[model samples]
Structures are given as structure tokens and as C-alpha cells.
Target chain A: MERKRASLKFLVTVMSNQAASTPAALKHTPLNATHRELSAKMVDFGGWDMPVNYGSQIEEHHVVRTGCGLFDVSHMLPLDIKGANVRAFLKRLVANNVDKLQVSGKALYSCMLNEAGGVIDDLIIYFMDESWFRLVVNAGTAEKDLAWMEKMNADWDMGLTLTPRRDLAMIAIQGPNATQALNHALPGVDSITAHLKPFNAAAMGEMFIARTGYTGEDGYEVMVLAKSAPFFWKALMEAGGKPIGLGARDTLRLEAGMNLYGQDMDETTSPLESGLAWTVDMKTERDFVGRAALEKSEITQQLVGLLLLDKGVLRGHQKVLTKHGEGEITSGTFSPTMQQSIALARIPLGIAPGEEVEVEIRDKKLKAKVVKYPFVRNGKVLI
Target chain B: MSIPADLKYTPSHEWVRVEADGTLTVGITHHAQDLLGDMVFIENPATGRSLAKGEECAVVESVKAASDVYAPVAGEVISANADVESSPEAINKDAYSAWMFKLKPANAADVAGLMDAAAYQKLVESEAH
Candidate 1:
């Protein structure tokens, strides 16, 4: 607990500090004006002027888990890969097997790795055809991912054209009633999306709707023309979709046990230690970019979920003391659904689930328990 | 924006209400809670703890982050408001009314040394820009 006695002063100081920094222009999503109209508190997130919340983040979080909530996820880049050898290029480029995606509109979650087995970015690859695939990657890492892909294309001599669709806007509507809300908003959408399974997608006119989301709930990530985003958002709101923001987005994802690219894993962290071993296809003899490095490296740390047994909210960067060794929290928050504090920590491998550990909060060490993740899914607490 | 004219204030945004019994009541201002947003946890100074002026004595955590509550004027912490500790949201709902601790001032004149409501309001206005 580093006492931020001057924290109120610090907030003012930070705002003043921003003046001294090079005032690089922040990018805006297509729904920027709508967010302002809704009285959203906007913040600079990875150079994008995105909404952190409408008013109350916790209330917005409940709206998503219980009813329906919409998020403007346009900052996430969508790249369309088209060529005869697109499948071949992806199989070599990503850690997961692109060969798994045999049917059209099927999605695969994979970590695009560096040669050193570090995660460059985690992405969702949607196979449209043998010659075409679409990848949705983290906003902050989009440039680096594209550069890496271009490098790989040149090196492999694969004539795939990677087209970044910046002309599009994406909105994710999520919750238990998401599908119904979406159907109500866009009549006849139920018929098209009804048969779609998890991790599947379909095209409806100019829109590409994926039955996928960051929040652990039934939803669609719909990509539409940028100009039509405002109208689409309004329609969804009218159909009972509450406008959620990034603050709630974070709490929702953390409760779902999903990994955030920057916090849960980064360039220096291996997927093996980052709770992403499943995404790394070790069974296949097919060599990928980081195959040799992953095979050669030994995993020392493992990511696990934690539930605080005592008072106090858990937060990122808190130190953990276990019998085996010390660890650190990757991401932590008070789960609005659980009414308790939960965290994902990277600790020594020997620490198994159900074992008790101590987490340092402020100066006091409080007791906590190691548990499996996905703490809450489908409005139910799992652990 | 709602600074009680009767209370004294600190540059750190804490409010001090001088009680008739020579004990002083303390809490964060409404402006402080508004800036912090959505209080989740609060740790008040333990009862009977002696403190110097401006000491980092208590802690208030919002969903966004944690912040320390400094002692406005040096005193002995006579009692802590357990209600604020358990239901931190009370502070966010009404920061001025949700007092954190009762302090027995070491020097009663020290309360006068702190800023009046008008001066504190001016400071807040300056900070906003």
C-alpha cells in the first residue's frame, strides 16, 4: 500500500503532466459523439478517445451480465487476408492451427507469437474460405501485428493481400438476452444468427456478424460501415441495449477469466506462463514461428485465479506470498457480480488450486485462495 | 462544489468540522469523492491512535484506484466511523456527511490555521482548470 496521501493533488498533477507530454492526437471511434451525448467519461486508451463508462461502471457491468449491453469495439483492428495460400500463411504465422478452421465463418483464437515464443498479440482468426481469412486483433498491437504479418508474407513469398478494414465500425452486444435484443433491433437477424454456434460468424448484407465477444456471454460482434454506426447503435439502444463503456468492459472480462492482451500477457511473457498453453498447438508437428522456442523453454510461472477471503479489494501488481514461491497479480478487481474481490495471478507452478495464499494489500497481508478461472459465466458463479 | 461554509479545509481536499466539545470531525469533501468515483473500500485510522498533522492516516479506495486520507490537523484519533469502513459507497453518495473519524485536536488553534470554505472553493476552482 503505497500511501497516495497527495492522490487528489496527484490527479491534478497528472492532468498538468499531460500538458508537458507531446500532445499526439488521439483516435476516435465512429460512435465518439454518441458517447459524449450519453455523458460518458472519456479517457485516452492506447491513443483512442474511448469511453471508460457512461456514469457508473458497476451498474453498466450488471446491465451486460443480466440484460443487454453494447460496446463500441471499433478500436480493435480487423484485417482481411485474401490469396490462394492464405490458409498456409496463417498456419505458419499463428501459434494455433489454422487447419482446424475447415468450415467457412468458423473462428479460431490464437496468439501471434514472436520467434522467441513471446506473445505479440492474441487474436481471433475467422476463416471465410481456403483463400481468405479475417483477423481481429488488439487495438494497441494492431500496427505491430500487421508489420509482423507483412514480414512473414515477404519471407514465405506468400502472395496474400492483408487489407486493414479501417472503414468499418464494430459493436458488441452482450448478455443473456443479447440475441433477443439483437433480433429486436435488426428484424430477421435471429433467423441468420440462430443456427450459428459459438465462435462462428456469418455475413448479412455489408455486415459481418460474429457470435463471439470478450464478455463471457452470448453476443455478436457486428462490423458495419463506419457511416452507419450511429444509426445502428441507436437502434440497439431502442431495442434495450444499454450503452456500456471500457470500465465495465474490463470488470466483465476479468470476471469471465478472459486474458487482456497487455495486462495478462505481453511481448516479454510466454503463452505457457500466461495461461494460454491451450491456444498453443503442441500436438502438431507443423512448425510455426515460435515452435522451437516453446519446445525448448521451460515454464516457471503459471496463471491462476484467486478469491480474496478477507476484506479489501484486490488490484493489479500486488505481491502474492505462497509456500512454494512469490507471485504477482496480473489483473485484479472487485467482481461486481460476486460481491467480492478476485484476481488472476502468475505464481510458481507448484501452487495448485484450493491452496491458501496471502496477498499484500497496503501494508497488511490478507488471506486468499487459489481457484480455477471463469469465476462467473452465464450469470452464475463457478468458483 | 458543495463546500460547507462552517467547516475548515485542507489543500488535500479533507474537511474538518470543529465540534462544540473541542473534538473535530473529519471526512473527505464532495468534490474529492466526485473526482475519485465509486468508493469500494475505506480504511479508517484505528481509535486512540495519535497522529501528526498531514499524516497519511486513512485510505479510501474507489473502483478506479486507492487514495490516502490525510489528517487535516494533528490530533489523537478518538474514534473511527465503522459505517464508512463497511459501506464505503456512503462517502460517494454524500462525502461531506459521511465522516471518517473523530479527532481530539492537539491544539484547538490549529483548526483556525486551515483554509475556510471560500478559500478551499477557490483552490478547487483553480485545480479544475
Candidate 2:
């Protein structure tokens, strides 16, 4: 038993180091050469050598807010689960209710939780049919999430066939003109995607197009063959979709009040406290993993949006002092649209919107106001 | 990318230009701004504040991350650039022209101890590898 435990500890260390590997050992997406050709500034993001920006990250962000921007999101894993029991399996696998997904191609955003009520990863589940489902998970947590799903599959005796779609590459075309650029790029995609609403997907040939995005904008997350990524990227560019990088992606998401996996929450953070309580579907009688723990857990903290009133920029891990208690900023960035700094903080409960809070930046405490998030959506500033 | 031969540099990437009046104008290097991506905010040390050599006296925050600007030599800050603080993107436009602060060095000769253009260029190259 001691030897087994020692080997388990070693395995955990090795797995965690996958994203901390040296630059030489970093992984590359299918569009690595394309990014290099575009003169993109590359950085080690979750062990993947990915582009941070082509030029000004703020400009790229504004482009996404106003016009069309293309992003190579191939690093995120596309997992397909197929079986007669696929729906049954997912009913207990994730926190959200799968029953809401009666219509085919409908997508549901959910948080997969551990037995301890901690979030494993937030993912988008697309119901293709009663027998098949597709899930898009975060890049950094792909391996561990897959392992967890595989373990649960066996433990529950659910004989579903899980396939990691590494052969596919995803591109997110976002902004107000996203659909126009997408239709221009693919020519006939408009006919298929024109009627599709948000949180819906459609498959044309081998490509999967979902009308969903991380940035709170009108966009589609299109998946194509990995070998065809560069061609698709070039086509999108020719169709007036400017290539955007991860740096802009981050700022855009923060302004949109989205949670990043590692930054906002992790294996130790519960979905209740991570501003994902709405996605947790506790009203359903269907039993899911972590439901018991979530039922018994006392909610002490709640995630809220903060608008920095001071001149400085708010950053992650900064202390947030509220009248109720102290909290920490999970994700923070300068919202180019608002021309102000915004952040998401997990503070003690009872700090209502419109209340003032102090965010400690270095030695000084800057004033910030608690506000309802989604700071910018579809080029409009809400707060 | 542009390391002016007349200017001096610190290992931390701050570039110092000695003015005709024996004062020094300081800003981040072009390479530093390139690495930090788009500029968002800047905080310069208060004017007349005494600083030690290599003391972190200013801050330059880009969209990607926040970095410190150290005092190249023991000095008193004479002026802070309000223009750059208001429009921090000026640094990305031209790092040398968007000086963050001015300092009256305790010893003007201390500028000679900092890295020259060629030495700083070499240091930046070495760091990239």
C-alpha cells in the first residue's frame, strides 16, 4: 500500500509538470506555422507554444468587439461520447441537467464537479443525438478531465465509447460581423447557420459549427479537420477576419465576465462560490456527482464583478476588501470597450451590487465598485 | 529593437538617456514593451523622491502583465511623465520617446556604469535564447 501511494504521488507530479515543461518541450497547435507566418508573438500557454498577439493586443481586442476576429482555439480538446447510454451517462456525470437538452444540436454550458463538490472543469456539452454527445473542455485541464471521465465511466459501469477528437481543429470567428465573415469564408455556411440560435450547433460535412463563444459576442466556434486549419484560417482572413491571439481573448473574456479555468476556479473551488451557481441546476431530482456534497456545503463566498474606480489596473490574486469580508480577484483586466479596469472577485456573500469595495494593489488600496458583470456585450458597455 | 547608442541600459530593461543638464530620462526598452504586449497603465515614482540604485521606483503594466522599472543609479526623481501615464500606448508606439520619469542622479557618472547599447542588445539576445 505504501509503495502504491508513492507511485501515485509520482504520477501526480508528472501529470502536473506537463504544462510547466521547458520551452523546447512545449506542444504546438496545428496552426503553429501559420501563426509564425503572421509574425505573431508566441508564448508558452499551458505547455502549448501559442501566439499571444500579432501586433497590439488592445487593437486585436477592439477588433473583436467591433468587427470580425478569428482565433485558433485548437488547443482545447473536443471529446465525443457515443453509446446508447450516452444521455444516461451524462445525466450523472455533470452538475447541470441533461434533460434540458431534448432538442438535437442544443448546447449547455456546465461545470463538471468532483465528489467533494469542487469544480473539475467547465465545459460546453452539445447533444448531437440520444446516442452521441460532444464536449469542448479547456486546454489545460483536458488530460485530467479525460482521466476523470474515464474513471467515472468504468465505476458507473457505463459502457460508453469516448473519443478524443484530436484530428479536429477549432476556430472561433467572433464580433458583430462574425457571421458575415464566416459566410464569406465558407460560401454556403450561411444557409445552414443563418437560422441557428445561440447555444446551438450544426454539422456540415465533417465540420461542426457552434453558435457559441467565450467572448460575449455573436460568433461561431467552427471545427474542421486539423490538416485543413491553415487553409481555413487563410480563407477566414481573406474573408476579412483578422487573426486574434490569446492576449485579446483573455481581455475580451474578462470584460464579458467569463471565468477562466485555472484562474477563477480549480479542483479546490466549488461552483457555488465561483459565480457558476446558475449553471449548477440543483432543482432537478436527477442524481449527479457532487450533488450530495453541494447540498451539505454551506455557501460562504460568492463571485461578483468589480469595476475599478482608481486609475491603476486590477490583477489576479489581488486582495478585495469588502464591508462583509475580504476576497480575492479571480480575473481582472482593463476593458478596452469601457476604458476602465474590471475584475471578477470571489468575495464573502452579502456584498450586493452597487456596493463599494477596495482592491489592494501593491501597498495602496484602490477603490472599486461591485457591479453586475457582462461589462461589455455586442460592443455595448452594460456597466 | 532600437537600442540607441547614446543611451544606457539596466539588466532589468530600463533605458536611461543622460540629458545635457546632467539629469536622466528613463523609459523601458523597445524589447521590454514588445515582450509585455500592449501598454495599459503606468505609475511613475513621485517627483523629488530619493531612490537607491536598482530600487524599483516605477511600474509599467501591459495587457499581458505588470513589470517594474528600477532606478538605474541612486538618484532623486525630478519629474514624472503625466503624458505617458495618460496614454501609456505611447511607449508601444516608441519606447524611447515615451520616457516615464526624469531623475537627477546623485552622481551623474553613475550612468557610465550601466550597459551600453551594444551590451544591452547582446543581453536581450541572450535572454531570447
The numbered model that scores best in lDDT is 1
List ranges where model 1 is wrong by over 4 Å. Answer: A1-6, A12-24
In model 1 chain B, where is the ten-residue run with the lowest total lDDT? B30-39
- Report lDDT (Cα) of residue A358, candidate 2: 98
Runs in model 2 deviating more than 4 A are: A1-24
Deviation in angstroms for A34 in model 1?
0.4
The complex in candidate 2 yields a DockQ of 0.31
lDDT string for model 1 (A1-383, tens) is: 35423465576445333322332477888898898899886777888888878878889999998999999999999999999999889889999999899899999999999999999999999999888899999999999999999999999999889999999999999999889888988988888878989899999999999999988988999999999999999999999999998888998999999999999999899999999999999897888999999999998999999999998888888999999889999999888899889999999999999999999987889999999998989888999
lDDT scores for all predictions? Answer: 0.89, 0.88
Model 1 chain A lowest lDDT segment of ten: A15-24
The sequence of per-residue lDDT tens digits that candidate 2 reaches over residues A72-171 is 9999999999999999999999999988999999999999999999999999999999999999999999999999999999999999999999999999
TM-score of 2: 0.95
